[model samples]
Target chain A: MAEISFPLPDLGEGLIEATVLEWLVTEGEMVERNHPLVEVETTKSAVELPSPQAGKVVRTYGEPGETIKVGDPLIVFEVPDDTAGIVGTVPKEEAPKRRVRLSANLDED
Target chain B: MSEHTTLSDLEAAQDNTTAADVQQESVQNFPEPADAGATETMSMQQALNRALAEVMTENPRALILGEDVGQLGGVFRITDGLQKKFGEARVFDTPLAESGILGMSVGLAMAGYHPIPEVQFDGFAYPAVNQIICQVGRMNYRSRGTLPMPITLRVPSFGGIRAPEHHGESLEAMFAHVPGLKVVSPSGPNEAYHLLKYAAARQDPVIFMEPKSRYWQKGPVNAGADAAGYSPNGSRVVREGKHLTLVAWGAMVARCLQVAELAAEDGIEIEVLDLRWLKPIDAEGLAASVAKTRRAVVVHEAPRTSGLGAEVASTITERCFGTLKAPVERVTGFDVPYPSGDLEDEYIPNIDRILYGIQRVLEYRRG
Candidate 1:
């Protein structure tokens, strides 16, 4: 398993720091992607931070009412190693299965 | 890593009746993916990451700079885990400015640093065209060899993921037209690994176009420390046949290979030639393959008007005119602004279209 630390993303336009209002999910809990992981209050407004990926929540940084800076570690999740943390949608490989047939090999030995 | 089946010793064997014979001896001489060395199954993304890592470790002067490349490991994560491995200075990020990224690379190259600048996406490269064509392309000639731009500009190119308009574009023709720029795109993980390292070790500027669509597609890659002998100068005969040749690069190469396989079911043998280097194209390789089959069809994601396919078709005609049976057919995208995800199915050439093209060439005859 690989440990991926989720950074506190910029919640709003240029918001530097946010106060942790509540932890929606506690440590050692299962989390689903896009679900509310934590609720934090920025200078402008309070918002819930979604889990970036599905994994087991190993740890969470900052307790309720504590301040955490943006771009800082928000939480760490343990996921299967093959799950690469990427931003875009990379299409899964689907190799077409076909019957084996001997095509001509024109190479002269 | 042990050398994986280097057919380098095999002489340039050409047989008119059998296009497959020249696979052992061709202009674009590289090991077969299965035999490229002690191989490991990896995606093109991982292969490229390994290449960048090796290049950075091998050359102290080498550095990678682009938006999100440092911390996020690039939007596609091609630079994943690199900044952590090599530190921030060598593998760092720049602001979201294509021109600034390329302009800074030019300056870094002038200062004797081998800069590997990533454009983020193919469509985003438009903002840096002035710097790319004017400075990066002409700096060596402008300085009269005093300044050799050893910069490898990595552009994640071509459409298939149904991305927004600018996110996916085949800009090979535009870059290839530039005199000083050497354009090359890898077709698979193995080619991505070898070609990227080869491009990095060059003095001239190389436009290393990575097929964004093929990023997740896995294949065997020889991730060894042997970077001394590989060169991305010519075209590779990926799959050989005697009927007709399917010429392509980037994402289209894989499509053509699939088309070839389907065509084989109909007893039509199609040779697939991966035109790796867009500029300084292996005219010899194109001629040699087409001459054997005496028929050809060029394919690409770019518009047919002046796509790289035109140059390839013209090269085949000029070199193998007498031996050719039919005019080289072009199976390509329509001449319009590349469409968004919804219309990509209609815009990009599908397998049926390519097969139809091959059919047209196969049936054509001189009066």
Candidate 2:
């Protein structure tokens, strides 16, 4: 098994950190790809973070009241060898040619 | 109260492919509704919602697009139930994108669709200024009359709600300055209903401003005789008096009427003029009112410096020159950023400020 650390993704509108509202998964819980892993709230709207791959949640980082900064570890997952190298921003199903809809990484119109 | 969202940041989330999702070919071919009902009391916001529903129903070409306008039914609920009533294919939400929504509307209008795109709030309009000022406002002239761009931009405006910064602003003068566009602000529900329908039916672009402050203010609305009630014939004289012409528009109209009643108690008869059409202002009607009253007080929530109040005052001086018994007076907000929550009362022109204008105008004598 390979351990993978997942950092908080940069939520747009210049929000640097967000308060954790709820944890959708507990440590050692098996989760499928794109399952909502955590609910975090910024000033404008509440957003749910989707897990990148199917894995056993090794550890969860923050309590409900804690604030997590972008690029900080949010969760740790123990994944099979096939799921290694999968990381933040890029969901498992995304292709190199396909454009992600995140606000910051948008290519020119 | 956070830092304003930048245009570049806003532009990033815009999905241009949504324009292709517009399935309808044209609105000109849509069937017209036979029944235009009689008077029913409703709030200004409710009347606006009804207007969008009726227009969407009658003209297959007319569609509404804005943030939270679809499933959320708008933050103000002005577009409440429209998406369900008309179908999401027509009344759909766009990405939290203003420029994208407004820019696509010009193309839709060119393709024979009447797109009633809402900007959500006044401060939000700045992000779409390029689309509004450069594109839709000049589509006809830029392409000649060959392309009759008839898009209606709905903006919820004004203060008194103590809303957050950039959420409440009075930027109508900026729109009114552009020559090719029509600027309209309805004082109450009846006008909101009729003027919206009229602007939708119009062949040119119109900036239909709704005073958010008076959104819940209720009054009768007769859809059939609605057109008969509001003729776009220069402001409606909602209250009649002889002391002076108390001119105001949007949310300020109700306030001016209240101030007029207060002045009446002091034996001053104030004629309240709701300048519904702010662009080609009711110069003739205003002249007539001023000639009759011999004094005029222009009121608005915008800053006094370079505000539309100054324009109204200048216009009165120009049209009602010899007949004017006194210099035109103005009741307006101070030249400062719209203050936050508790400081709103001191910002918006209240009844006392309006009364001061009337009193000042009354004291003036032609020298």
Every model: Cα RMSD to truth: 9.7, 17.8
Model 2 regions more than 4 Å off: A1-109, B1-38, B225-229
Model 2 TM: 0.70
Candidate 1 lDDT, B1-367, residue by residue in tens = 1221111211122112122211221235453443344569988888899899989888767889999888767877788888888777777899899999999999878766789999888999999999999999998788767777889999999887767768778999999999788899999988899889988988788999999888878888766754344455588898999988999988888888888888888787889999898888899889889889988999998988999889999999999999988899999999999998668867888777888888787767579
Put down candidate 2 lDDT per residue, B268-331, tens digits, no spaces: 7789988888887877778777888787899999888888988898998998888887788888
lDDT of each structure?
A: 0.82, 0.76
Could you tell me the lDDT of residue B210 within candidate 1? Answer: 95
* Residue pair clashes in candidate 1: none
Error of 1 at B191 (Å): 0.3
**Candidate 1 runs further than 4 Å off:** A1-6, A10-14, A27-30, A43-46, A52-59, A76-88, A92-109, B1-35, B225-231
Highest DockQ scorer: 1
Give residue B359's lDDT in candidate 1 (0 to 100). Answer: 78
